[model samples]
Every structure is written in C-alpha cells, then in structure tokens.
Target chain A: ENRNNVDSNFKNYLINLKNLLFIYLYQFLISLKIVFSSFIHRLIALCHPEKSIKNQIVLITGSGGYLGRHLALEFAKRNAILVLWDVNEDANRQTVEQLKSQGFFKIYPFKVDLTDQKAIKSTAERIRLTLGHVSVVLMVAAASFKAKSILDTNFEQDIEMHFKISYLSQLWLIQEFLQPMINKNWGHFLTVSSNSALIDMPLISSYASFKLAQTKLIETLREELIFNGIDGVKTTIAYPSILKG
Target chain B: ENRNNVDSNFKNYLINLKNLLFIYLYQFLISLKIVFSSFIHRLIALCHPEKSIKNQIVLITGSGGYLGRHLALEFAKRNAILVLWDVNEDANRQTVEQLKSQGFFKIYPFKVDLTDQKAIKSTAERIRLTLGHVSVVLMVAAASFKAKSILDTNFEQDIEMHFKISYLSQLWLIQEFLQPMINKNWGHFLTVSSNSALIDMPLISSYASFKLAQTKLIETLREELIFNGIDGVKTTIAYPSILKG
Candidate 1:
C-alpha cells in the first residue's frame, strides 16, 4: 500500500510539473510570436527589394482631410508635382486653394473617387500628361473613426471599412498609377496606415489586417522591383498613431 | 553661338548627373536611418529587457478618448491589470463597465484631473493597494487631433499639449506607477506615439518632438535597468497611424 501510494503521488507531481512547463512555454511562445511576426515583416522588406518597385506610380488618395491636406502640403512643398485625388470636391478645392495661397505652386488637386477604377484611370492619364511621370503613392483617409472594439462594432460596416478605404483604393491606384511608374527608372510608394498593423490590435481588426496587407505588399514590391534591374524604386510605409482626439 | 551653347549644355549635363548621384546617396542614407532606428529600438528592448519590463507601468492622462480606450483594452488583455486615470467620470464608468463585461477582472478606473499630481497620487495609491502588485504601464490618450496642420496649429496649444499630455503625465506616472514597477523584478511599458517619431513627418511637429522625448526616456530606462542584475523589464513604443475617420 505504501509503495503504491508513493508511485501515485509521484505521477501526480510529474503531471503538475509538465503543466507548469507548458504554461511557461506558452508564455514564451506568445512573446516569440510577436517578435517573429515583426521580424518577418521587416525581413521580407529588406530581403525582397525587387518585388517592391515594379510598375508603381505615386497616388495620393485622400487629398482633402486634415491628414490628406498635410500630406499634400508636404509633397507640394517638396516640389513633387503629382495627382492629388480625393472624392471630396470641396476639400480638394480647399487643399489646392490653401496650397496656392501658402505659395505651394506645383500642386493641383484632381478630384477623383479613388474607389472607382474609371475615375482613377482618367485621373492617371491626366497625371501622365501633366506630371511628366508618376512613381510614388500615399493612401490616406478612410471611413469614420468607429473606435469600438470588435465585439461592439457592427459586422457589415467593419468589413467595408478596410476594403473601401485602403485595399480597393490602393489596388486601383497601383493598377492605374504604378503601371506607368515602372516604365520610368524610378518610383517610391507610401501607404499611411495605422499602427494597429503591429500586433493583436483590438477593435481595429479590419484596419490592422489591411495595414498588415499593405505593409506586405510594399515588401513584395521591394523584392520584385529590386531583382528586375529596376533598382531605382523604393517604398516607405507610414504608420501613425490615432491622432489625439 | 554653337560652340558656347554646346559648352553650356555639357556643364548642365554634368551638374544634373552630380545631382542625381547626390539624390541617390541621400535616399540610401534615409533608408539606413530608418533601419538603424528600428534596430536601435530592438536592441534597447533586448539588451535591457529588465528595464523595459519595469518601465512598462505608466499612468495615462487622457485615458478616456478613443485611442486611450483601445490602448487600455490592449493593455488589459495582454499585460496585467491597469489603472485608468481619466478626468471624465462617465467615460471612466463606461470603460470600467466595458472592461468588466469583457472579462478583464482586474481593471480599476479613477476619475482624477491629471494636472494635479496629488489627486493622481491618491487614486494611484488606491490602485497600488488593490492590486498589491502593479507593474507594466501604458500612457496613452492625449489631445492633439484638431484639423490644424503645422501652419494652422496654435502654438500655445501645441506646447500645452506636449507639456500636459506627454511630459507631465510621464513625470507623474514615474512618481506614481513606474516607481513601484521599477522596484519590482518585472515591467513592460509603452507610449502611444505617432509615426512622426520616425520620418520628418510633416504637420505634427510639436507632437512628434514630444513623443521623441518619450522614446528617449524609454531608451534611458533600458540602459539604467540593464546595468542592474534584474532582467525582467521592457519598454515598447508604438508609432501609431490614424485609423479610419
């Protein structure tokens, strides 16, 4: 009886030890997952420069909101003459007006709905004629700030938010803008995404996933473009925090 | 006329080539800067894990807005418990209620004006007593998302925002929350910063400069904490993006 008791207790102790070890391993794994994902994202960018630069034109989607306005202001101030596309005609008009007023002479806002390919194409053609060449792109502005967590968020609107704002606009812009820029010897691209792309961002799953996709696209572009003897193009992704509300 | 024209053309061609070369080098430098900055951040975190861990406990000032809310949610889910310090009582009530509903069983909310450290301390001590072990922090929730760019931003508000939100809260939190965390063997901290901390992000100059200060402090904490033997601390920073509207 004593011998049997000893064996049974030993077995229970071993099992408990095993469970604790598993928890410790799980904790380390959680940390590693975060580190690994970040590393992979960066590694893809650095390792695959060619996949990034091929056939890209600079397209700024939201040339109207405060963020868009500031971006337009910066590009124009830097003497970059390109298409400033925005669905908001008044915001677009005001941006151009403000730029001109502020002595940013090179910028001209071209009102276009970024979501519509036809509109994007028409504007791209106009850009090809006027801007001499298109090479970089910046996508800013999106659906309203519904900062509710995933549980609180309405499912339909959540799905629509990322696609309508980032993915679709970026895809159309790349098809329209980047195709021409690749023919040129150079290009650079930037997507103004949210930092939610970094990790298990709550409430902003839609935004985070798309930003992650955008960041990945840049990495792929980097890889493809660099390998094809077209080493002149580059892409920079900007992830700003929630503007202090 | 032909000989002089040819000479002028040749001179212009050489100058343009030099300019192109210079531009290429500048781009290389910019890329290097970005990579270096990220690497440095990683190095600080890894080399000084203990410090980073201990410094994680922060007292968020505006801990009530959308950004603050989401970040608070992240901290509660991933890190240990949190002491939400916000001036708005209704918001705090809702935040606490939401956290409870979400099954984060360890969140405590305090409605206190941030401008006064004494008030902050009173609530903080209560948090410290209740938790018995409070380490790891996040100072999120600030106010700066007005529709004003650099040109239109009021200088006083810009300075006031930095002083009140980033710096003052940083100081107070160090006194209240961070001190306890540092005394303990572990901590992980973060500042809800903007990507302006990286590139010459135009428009949010004042805000960016202050955030840069936060980054520097974290770096210092890493160095100081690592020099000691405790390797259970970490300080992480996020350069956030503007999520949907």
Candidate 2:
C-alpha cells in the first residue's frame, strides 16, 4: 500500500509540472503575438506619410534661432499660420520678412522674453485673441552653450540662465498653451532636445541637466494626456546631434 | 559551365556563412561571460554587508527632517563625525541635542538656508574651517510638498522655490564641496531622490522636474568622475518610494 501511494504521488507531481509548463507556454505565445503586431504596425506607419499641417495655427518659440527659423519656414510652406516668438526683436523681424518674401503672409511676430512668466502669459493671451486657438506648439529655445567645467560655471548667472530658458520657460509656455489643446483634445507639442540629454558628457553639466529635465517633463505630459484619453494630442521629442546650422 | 559556376558560388557562400556564424558565436560567448560575471558580482554584493562609516566626516542636508535624522543616528552608531545643515534653526539644534543624548558627541549643527547661494558658500567655508574636509555629503533637502496641479502652482513663488531648493541649491553645494573631494580622489556623494523623478506621475510637475534634474546631475557627475579616473569618489542615488515619515 505504501509503495502504491509513492507511485501515485510521483504521478501527481508530473501532472502539476505539465500544467505549469502549459501556462508558461501560453503566456510566452501571447507576448510574442504582441511584439509581432506592434512591429507590423510600426512598419506600416513608416511606409505611410504623415498628415499635412496646412491651415493649422502653429506657435514656434526661438523663431530667430537656426533650427527654429527653418522649422517656421517649413510650416509656412505647408500653409500653416505662424506665430513666431523670440527675445531678439531684429532677428525675429528678419524671420518675418523672410517668410513674407517666400509669399507666406499669415505671420505674427512677438519679441518677448520667454524667461519672464508675465511676458509669456500676456503674449499667449495676445496670440489667442489675434489668431484664435493655437493647434501646435514647437519649443525650440535654448541658452548659448557654455563649454566649461561644472566648477568654472557661475551658479547665479550661467547655470540660472540655462535652467530658465531650457526648463522653466518650457514649463511656463506649456501651462500657457496646453489648456486650449486639452479642451479641444487635438494638438501637437514638439521640442528639440539634444543628444546630450541622453548621454552624460563632461563640461556641460548645467545644460545636460536642464535638457534632461525638459525631456522628462514632456514624457510626463504625454503620459498624463494619454491617461486623460486625449489621443488626438500628440507629443514628439527630437534629439538632434550637433547641428551645424 | 553556367551550372558549374552556380555550384562553386553556392559552396563559397556556405563557407562565408560558416565564418559569419562562427564570429557571431564567439561574440555571443564573450557577452554571456561578461553578463554572468557582472550578475555574480552583484549577487555577492547583495549577500555581503556594506562597509562601516567610522571616522568619516559626513554632512547631512535637511538633518532636521525624518530621513535625515535617521541617517544621522545610523552614522553616529558607526562613530562617524556628523555635520548637520538645516534651514530650521530650532529643529537643527534639537537634532544636535538628540544626538548628544544618544551619546554621540561629535555632532556639528548649522542653521542656514540652502536656497541662498551666499549662505551656502559661507557655511561651507565655515564647515571646512571648523571640522576639516567632509568625506561624505548626503543631499536630503527638498522644498515642502505642495499638492496642486501644474496650472494652479504659482510660477514665481512655489515653482521658483521648488527649483531653488531641489536643483540650484544642490548645484551650489556640490560646487562648494566637490573640489576637495576631487583633490583627495576619495569621497562619497549620496542624494535621496524620489521615484517620481524616474516615473512621470500627474501633479507635482514642478517637484518632479527638479528632482529629475537633480538625478541627472548626479549621474553626469558620476560619469565625469569616472572619465577623470577618480574611481575613489563614489556616488549613490537612492530613489525611495513614498515614505510615511
């Protein structure tokens, strides 16, 4: 009787092992399906072209800068209404003239310092009054790169300016413009981040720190939008590596 | 002759394929060896205990707060000299007294606001003068938590305070103290960061942004140290989940 009991116990253990193997195999197959489907979806998206931005009211910060000006020109070519903001009044006016020369007439230029909260708010209000609600915001502002060791960088001046432009200004602008996008559930938010934000390099601690913070903020905002079921609002972060222009 | 050429080409292709497979197998073996060694090293570290902090001059920011006080007591048990910094004068003095009552006599308490750059510089100088060089710096200070949406949070007051205490102050302190550590090439810098820095949760946008910046700064600092071949200067970032205290 004892021998029979031992045999039955061994048989039961094998049966339990089989059941566990079946469960694991089922889960593995499900995960593989998910991976394959996502790959196919991405392949399809790569083959298809994106939608046109014509007739969209797009706001571009740092419109006087190299990347910003090019982005503005691209949107203008697409027939999107452009609202250009820059601290340099002369450079901003030059951008406006360039756009006009290209035969794009719907351009509004604002020479306002983004570091100032009040300036950002007032300018955002003015833009809303003039151009209706903005459908896209492209944050492209950044402080001049100070290539110095962390020890040599001035905390109050250089580092503070970097944080103000790269991080604080972005936060303020998002707050100023995100309400309309949330209300309508249709908008695009894009920011040009640097590869330094991803790789930790020496001699640019302040810049890297702020850029990383900006990237994290946008990622958080994306999660919040998705959680709220605002699928129409899209976010993109471009990490450009050492652009000459 | 064409069929002969095809056969020869197929044979050569098989030979090339074999060579490629062999190279890949060799690389795969090397990678597996590296991964296994690192895993074993980590497992050993987990099993073994940490080194004692005796005879180390440890500086604790926000020593009046919950985690800071506990860390102080722990180091005190290990017979390390404690330098406590806090903005709250009474609470800092209370911590000193508490340490004294617990029979840890080598405790220095300073009441200075970390947000003030001048205050940080002056106090850091005083600590160097009085207690010699600190071998460990524990950055545990943070702005008081304000539970509000990003829009509701005041840009000038609340958000500014968050940046001041969280990112700027830490930067200032590191600037003031890091030189000596670099010279000696032996020290430890640890900071208590929030899990919010890693995962972007809704609300606490200001706090999360700064915390994320702080985390990135430390990571960058670590890379700098490694690049400079100062391996003795260790850095640790503790991401504690929600704490009741």
Candidate 3:
C-alpha cells in the first residue's frame, strides 16, 4: 500500500507539472500569434490602404519634417484625413500648401508643440469635434540628430527634445483624441518609429533611450486593452530608418 | 549655319532632359533604398535579436515593477548589469533584496519619478556617478491604473505622467548613462513594451498613446543614429507580447 501511494503521488506530480507547462506554452504561443497578426494587419493597412480602410481618420504628427512630410503625403494620397501636426509652423505651412495644390482638402495642419500637454489636448479636441471620429493616428513627428559618440551628444538638450517632441506628445494626443473611436468600435493608430529603440547607438543616446521606454509602455498597454481592440481600436507602429540628407 | 544652330539647341535640350531624368531616377532609387533597407533591417532586428545583437544593451525597463522584477532577474541571470530604476521604493528594495539573496550584487536600483526633470537629472547624475558607462537604457517604469483612455486620460496629468515616466525618463537615463559607453564604442536599448504600442487599444488610451509616441520617436531617431551601431552605439527594439502571464 505504501509503495502504491508513493507511485500515485509521483505520477500526479508529473501530471500537474505537464499541465502547467502546457498552459504556459499556450499563453506564450497565443501572445506570439496576436503580435504577428497585429503586425501583418498593420502593414497591410498602411501599404495597401486602397484595399479597405473605411471610417478612419488618420492623424500624422510632425507632418513638417522630412519623415513626417513623406508619411503625411503618403497618408494623404491614400485618401486619409491627414492631420498634420508640427511645431515648425513654417514647415507645416509648406506641407499644407503643397497638399492644397495637390487637391488635398482632408489635410488639417496644426502647429502644436508635442511637448506641451495643453496644445496636444486642444488640437485633439478640435479634430474630434470637427472630424467626428479618428480611426488611425500616425505619430511620425520627432527630433533627429547624429553624432560620433554619446559623450559628444548633447545629453540634456537633445535627449529632452526627443522625449518632448517624440515621446511625450503622442501620449497627450491619444489621451485627448481617441475616446470617440473607442466608443464607436473602430480605430487604429500608426506611428513612425525607429529600430534604434531596440539597438543602442553612441551619439543618439537620447533618441534611442526615449524610444525604448515608449516601446515597452505600448507592450503592456496592448495586453491591458485587448478588449478595446474587440471594441475596434488597434495600435500599430512602423520603425523605419531615417531618410534625410 | 541655321541648321547647325538648330542642331546645337536640340543637343542642349536633350542634355537638359537627360539631366532631369537622371536626377529623377536617382531620387526614386534613393527613396526605394531608404524604404526597403529600413523596413528589412528593422524587421530583422525585431524578429532576430540574437543573430543581430552586435553592440546593443538589450534593455528591459521597469526593472522594479512586478514584470520588471522578473525581467530584471532574468536579465541578471544572463549577465546584464540589471539597470534597475524604479519609482516604487518597496518594489526596488524587494528586487534588490531578492537579487542580493540570489548573489546578484550588480543590480542597480534608483528611486525616480520619470516626469520630474530635476529628479530625472539628479538620478541620471547619480547613475553616471555609479555606473560610469552604459549604452542601452531600458524604459520600464510607468504610471498604471490611472493610465487612462485617451478621452478619459487627463490632459495635463496623462501627458505629464506618461511622458515623464514612460518617455522622458528614457531620455534622461540615456544622456547620463551612455556617455562613457559611447566613448568605449557600443550599446543596445530594449524595452519591456506592450503589444498595445504594437496596436492602438481603446480602453488604455493613455498607455497606448504614450507607447505609440515612443515607438514613432524611436523609429525616426534610428534614422539619424544609424552610425551609432557601426560607428559606436547601436539601437534595437523588441515588441514582446505580455510575458508568460
């Protein structure tokens, strides 16, 4: 009897261990599935907007900068209601003018500093009120620079600029602009981001560091808001190398 | 003579035409190269870190939170310095205590409010004083629960908290920690980011927005800092699904 009991107990322990391992594996696989699906879906949405993107208001921030302008034009060409937000009023104006000449009426230019919460909120509110709903937001605005070494990098100024212009502003914009889409059961946000967030580089410490933080913030946010996607809100990110002279 | 003059004019016109065509083609090829290389390289970095982790720090931020704690432990096991920065005193203490018990003396902890510039600066300076050089800085600390929906998210508070903790903190840490690393020639900054930044979610608009912004910021930053990896510092990012829950 004692021998039987020992055997049974050992068998049960193995069974439980097997079950736990399976459960863990399942979760891991599921999470991976979700990630890959989300990523592929986003690419399709961005590259082939013509296939289908209904009831979506696309907001492209920093539409003035080289990257921002290119993305803004792409979104505009896709017939997206492009909201061009930039701190550089002149650049924003130039983009707006060019778009206007190109017959882009859906394009809205807002000269707002991404660093300022109030500015972001006000602008988002304006878009919500006027546009009725925003389905996609493309955060393509940011500060950029190059350097030989991190020691030579303007640690304070450059890094601060990255956080304010690149990182923080997107948060403010979403807080102010995204509720209606959530309620309506349809929205997607797209941002132009960088691979630098993953790998580290010498001169652009500020840029890479800030980008890394933002990446994680979204990862957790994805889990907490899975139900929200069920409500029709999807967030997407694009990490492209900078294209500039 | 008139025919000869006409021929010369035609020749000049043809030369001008060729020049214009050459310029246009060059521009087109450049754009294509930029888009394709960036897209492929970023995808490679995201999908295959081990194969491509040249000089990246491969950071895991929020090294003091519940998930951050586990991540820090994992990183430590793998020989990471365990750059543990957090706002939670107890959490940081618990992590440090636990790690110390496990024989991890290299775990570095700091109490910091990501939003407070002074705090960020001071903490950074303290980090610099302690860890002379670091390349990759993970952004892990973030405001939670109150992390609201974009619409429900407070304008001033949401942006302040998100950017300060999630975005700005990265900037400050990198500026202070990476100077020496850059001089020595390398780093990688990864984040324990959410899938939400991977896709926009409705409920956690604040989190999503901040994450999205950070994502976008890093994407652009990478463009300018490409040489960091080859020259000295490299940047890379990972968008993991929630860890084995």
Candidate 4:
C-alpha cells in the first residue's frame, strides 16, 4: 500500500507540472502572436505613403472652435479647399478672414447650427451644389465641457446637448457625406473623440458617455465600410488628451 | 577595417539580442500579472457567499418582453416583490398574471411609456409612494432590432427610438432611483447590454452605439460611487450573446 501511494503521488506531481508548462507555453505563444501582428501592422502603415489632399474639398465642422481653426489652417496650407461650418457667425467669419489674410483663398465659411438637422442638411446640399463633393470630413466640434456629476446634470439641458454635439451631429454629417464618398470611391473621416471616451474620470459622465458613443459610431462605420469592401473610404478616430483650449 | 567591421557587427548583434530578451521579458511579466490578478479575483468571488434577495423590492423594466417575463418568473420564485414596467399594458398585466398563477402575489405591474419622461417620472413616484424604495433595478429593456445598415437607418424614427429605449430610459430610471439607493446603502444595478456593444457587427449600428452608451453609464456610475466611498451600492453589466427574445 505504501509503494502504491508513492507511485500515485509521483504521477500526480508530473501531471501538474506538465499542465503548468502547457499553460505557460500557450500564454507565451498568444503574447508572441499579438506582438508580432501589431509590429507587422505598424510596419505596413509606415510603408504606405501619405495621401495628398491638394485641391480636395475638405469640410470641417465647428470651424469657430480652437481645434477647428487650427485644422482649417493646416488644410489651407496643404492647398485643400476648406468648407467651414460653425454656428457662431462671428467666429466663422473670423476664421475665413484669418485664412484669407494668410493668402488661402479657397475657404468657404457657412454659419450653420450642427444641432439643427435641417440646417446641416441644407448647408450640406448647398455646399455640394456650389463647391463640388467634399472628399474629407473633419468632425472636431464638441459641446463645451461642464464639470458636473451625473446627479447634478439635467437630462434635457446638459446631457441632450452633449448627445447632440458629440453624437447626433456626427451621425447626421456622416449620413450626408458617406453615400457620396462611397460613390466617388475616395473619402476620409477624421473623428476627434476625446480621451474621456477611453478613461474613467469624475464629474464628466455625460460628456464621457456621448464621446464614447461618438467613438462607437465611427468604429461601426469603419467596420461596415470594410465589410462592404470599400477600402478607398477611410476612417480615423483621434482620442486626444485634455487640451488647454 | 575587417576587424572593426566584425567587432561592430558583434556589438550590434548583442544589443539586438538584449532588446529582444527585454521585450519578451516585459510581455511575459505583463501576461503573468494579468493572469495572477484575475485568478485572485475569481478566488475571492468564489469564497464570498451569494447575497439573498428574499422579499426585496425589485423593479424590472420591459417586463412585457421575453427576457423580462422569464426574469419576472425567476425573481418571483426567489420571493422578491416585483414591480414590472412596460409600455404594452396587456403584456405587463400578463406577466403579473403569470406570476400570480405561480403563487407569487407580490407583483406590481405599471403601464409606462419609457420614451415619455413625464410618464416615467410619475410612475416612478407612484412606485416609491406605494411600495417603499426599490432595492434592485434590472435594466433589461431594449428597442427591437432591425438589421439595417447605418445608411438605411433613419435618425428620427429608428435610431432615436433605439436611443430612447436603450440609453435614455436607463438614464432616467437610474436618476430616479440612485439617490434613494445611496441613502439606503444597499442597492444593486444590473444592466443587460447586448453583445453588439462589444463586437464589430454590420447593420446594427444604432442599437450597438446606444448599448455601448448604456454600458458607459453604468461603468461611470460605479466609478463615481466608488469615488464617493459608497461601496454598498453595486453595479453589474451583462453582455449576453444574441437571444431570440
């Protein structure tokens, strides 16, 4: 009986050791596969030359805002035709003036409310009639941030506003432009989502939720585009950290 | 020159080998840490006994729907008081009847339009006045899924309905009940999010986006509760596979 017990104990020890080794090996291979695939993806992305946007009609929403103004300037420098949309008339005109002063003459400024779907559709139609089809859309507009917890935030006033700006506006714009982009077989969507969408923070529940929704919208759009084999139309989502502006 | 070239090549080879070793070690350590932590968490959860909900007031939205009816049966079996909310009056009454036939008398059915804020508020108030404070909320309500791609989906009708049912209703319900839950220091929030939220799927963009938003809301709520040192209130989000219901 003592001999049999010793043999069984030895067999169990070997089995446990073998199982532990197998588990570690499986984990190591998974890690290796992940690392290798990511490395290859980065390498491929680096190999692709930057696409030129010269003379392309680039529609930028929230052109009155700080990031929008900067993006407009950059696109202008690249010789792309800028169609700037902003609800604030003064700020929109100021952006147009700033671009004109810099000798960027292909700037079209439209004072449009993103929250109003009718205004967005009409303005988009007008742009298409006048300026040709827009090939790129930069969604940079976001509702102003207010530091309030979920309990303190009002649903209709605060949360709805965020939902409109961060989510609904993007939805409407994408709906307006995506069909044309697919027909043309070349377009780009640059969605400016915030870091709040990816992280947990205090007192920004409404902002974070809608921002996350925006990210999901863009993500699903990309997936659908890919599923349809529309490779020419690309979507990029930027999750920028908190900015001073 | 030959000796110098050989020495340089050898040095470069050694450096590359060192970097490769470092990278593998770092990845391995990360994987190990993740595995160890999850194992410990599972062990801790297993050691803790399940909490009893006998005679507790449990509010379940969408009680007229398939999952809701089944949940109603389960909770009734557990001897918990069920407050069922559904826009379909007949279906809600049927759920109550089913429970009653099963010898569960503590069932309350309310015909409330989740899309209407006023109805939800008033109905919630009535529940509070008549049935004491609800200790558990099961958010299982969702808009019916239509397999239409983003372009085919209408913003006002289809998307808005999904947003109202999936995201807004949860927001309103949580707002109504959370403060009371905090006061009681014993509450549980169970959110039934769909698998679409986590996976990339075509033709369900609207449903997926709002479901993701629902998840974010619950996550942020839990974080906020933790930040406030309110550990008694618990939040759990479920990402179930596609259910026929």
Query: In terms of DockQ, which candidate is strongest?
Result: 4
lDDT for each residue of candidate 1 in A3-66, tens digit (9 for 90 to 100): 9999988876776566456545754676677667768888887876434322333357787888
lDDT of 1 by residue, B93-210 (tens): 7777887799876666778776566887687777667556556567775656443333243435654566456545554565555555556766666667665555443245446545
> Any idea what lDDT model 3 has?
0.62
Sort all candidates by DockQ, best to worst: 4, 2, 3, 1
Q: Rank the candidates by TM-score, best first.
A: 4, 2, 3, 1
Clashing pairs in 2: none
Candidate 3 lDDT, tens digit per residue, A157-188?
Answer: 56667766665666666566566665775666
Model 3 per-residue lDDT at A83 = 74
Write down the worst ten-residue block by lDDT for model 3 chain B: B51-60
Locate the minimum summed-lDDT window of 10 residues in model 4 chain A.
Answer: A19-28
The worst-scoring run of ten residues by lDDT in candidate 2 chain B lies at B19-28
Candidate 3 is scored at a TM of 0.50
TM-score of candidate 1 versus the correct structure, residues matched by position: 0.40
lDDT of 2 by residue, A117-209 (tens): 899999999888877999899999888877777677776667778888988888888888888888888899898888777656667888888
Error of 2 at B143 (Å): 1.4
- Candidate 4: pairs in clash: none
lDDT (tens digit, per residue) of candidate 2 on B151-181: 5666676777878888888878789889999
Lowest-lDDT window of 10 residues in candidate 1 chain B?
B49-58
Ranking of all candidate structures by their lDDT, best first: 4, 2, 3, 1
> What C-alpha RMSD separates each model from the true structure?
21.8, 21.0, 22.1, 16.4
